[model samples]
Target: MTRSWIGRRAVVAATFLLALSPLAPAAAAPPVVEAAGAALRPAGAEVVAVTKVAERLTDLSVRSPALGGRVVKVRLLTPDGWNPADRRQHWPSFWLLAGCCGDYTAWSGTDIAKIESLRKVLVVMPEAGWNGWYSNWWNHGAGGDPAWETFHTVELRRLLEKDWGASSNRVVAGLSMGGQGALLYAARHPGMFRAAAAYSASAHPLLNTESINRIMGFFGGQGGDPRRVWGDPVAQRNIWAAHDPYYLAHHLKSLPLYLSSGDGTAGPFDQPDALEADFNRQNKALAAALTQAGAKRLTTNFYGPGTHAWPYWQRELHSSLPILLTALNVRP
Candidate 1:
């Protein structure tokens, strides 16, 4: 019995190391660590329902405490032959965030399903709210419900990590607003992700006056007080600073970062008259800031011809596979 116990500890120790090793594939289920208050919620939070949407697609409705105990939809795209029922199987996780006005189905409609590297990862797509900004509302500095930050980073994270076959080795990617979210989450929660990729991200919303006002307008248009999102830009400078990627670039220094965007010019995928240069402008500033901040690892693609559309984002998403897969350690 003592010999058997020693062997079990050795295997468990090796599995823990594999979670951090880039070249090693993930083990089955992660070794159960001592759970604290909220981290234990994953084991307790009820998986209200699970529906298999496709051979590889499964959608679930989870009652999340971070979302004020409201039931939200989370979609999962499993790799080939992935089985969630097998307690002895686990896979690395890839979180695909959606942009404004998008939901769990955003990335589903794209050609991402065809990627070969996907076979090694479990993709997580969560509802970030209609215009959640991936943040807990500032509520005029009072702070309140719709805690998107807590929901995604804490609540949902625990849910997937504990219940689903998601391992600690993870990477996040998104487009447009979700592009901002990918950076925000990575910067705000240092070491939570191995790397982050943003396609047409708004990396530096507070970099300039025009950008500031533009973000404010976006916040206001979505039917919420602008101050409620991050408080007044002046009085609550710290709050805004906390949310802006440019200001928080230091946290991303150690992680593999990928930033991509176009100059809003019409491309094969967009109409001739449409221009989404604002994102291009922000993406450039972010790239510059990350550089100035001495971020040791970074990758950028400022491809200057596309607009804010799925085609451009889709292409970038595919192009970013090398970086994304490398971060997840699914590739060399």
Candidate 2:
């Protein structure tokens, strides 16, 4: 019975060891292991989750009591010796996101992990489950979940900062569908985030009514009213306007903005028919509209040979990182 066994809360019996000695001699003590950052294994670009996230930077699967049965899985990326309460002025963070039917772990597993050179800034990737839309479902019909917008914008931010030392200055960005969320959240909550970036983001939700319908069907029924989440695009034009990044072009001038997309020719979403042309034209029009609105201090990139896939998003993020740093003013 050595002191190491006591340190780890393992029950050690010398009698058991003596009994085993009859079969084989006592083995040498293994190295004393510390349970600090030692729990994580170094993956190529990402840190593998080891221990549970009760104390520090780890993946946490939390059921938001406020949002009914909807569960939020988050990967809390933190620096070494991270303390949530210690407010020593850390770098601002961005909530990197994924598309519809994507989980929280997507960004961490994707190529975006390599672009996270600004270690001070932590990225919290939260899962928006099947057709959650990151918006609150109307009528409380599907699981009676409160608006997810409130949960992410208000609750999740406060929780992470208070418990995980996540900085107050944060941006929310994503690819495809999440791109729309990042833009919408930034436009709606103008003062909340310093900058918002979206790559191949679904620019106009109202335009793609049928796709929205299909996505909504996963939660409850087909063609369910979207205003339940974002309000009537017609009657609630003001609310929908608040989310239109192109319409709110003035707000984005000073606030950092990044937009990028691939040619609508190769991706799964890009059905090579008139439907694809409509989406492409709409997105292109949005970008052009922002430019025509005299929106300044913004960067927009279009990839020629790429399609809407992980590889394209990876490249986009790599290119967008420098711009994000400049916007957030994070050096090194």
Candidate 2 stretches with Cα past 4 Å from truth are 1-57, 85-89, 140-143, 207-228, 231-242, 267-279
Name the best candidate (by lDDT): 1
lDDT of 1 by residue, 1-332 (tens): 12211222111222222211110001112112112233433223457999999878899898876666778899998877677777667788899998876777889888767887887799999888766788878661244357777778877777787778787788999976788899888877766788899987768776655456656655654345655677676666677777778777777777888888878677776653222577678778888878898988898888878767777778888888788788887972
In candidate 1, clashing pairs total 0
lDDT of 1 at 26: 12
Index of the highest-TM-score prediction? 1
| lDDT agreement with native, every candidate | 0.72, 0.56
lDDT of 1 at 258: 86
Error of 2 at 274 (Å): 7.7
**Candidate 1 residue spans exceeding 4 A from truth:** 1-44, 140-144, 272-275
TM-score of each: 0.83, 0.70
70, model 1: CA deviation in Å? 1.3
Provide the clashing-pair count of each candidate structure: 0, 4
Give, for candidate 1, the lowest lDDT window spanning 10 residues.
Answer: 19-28
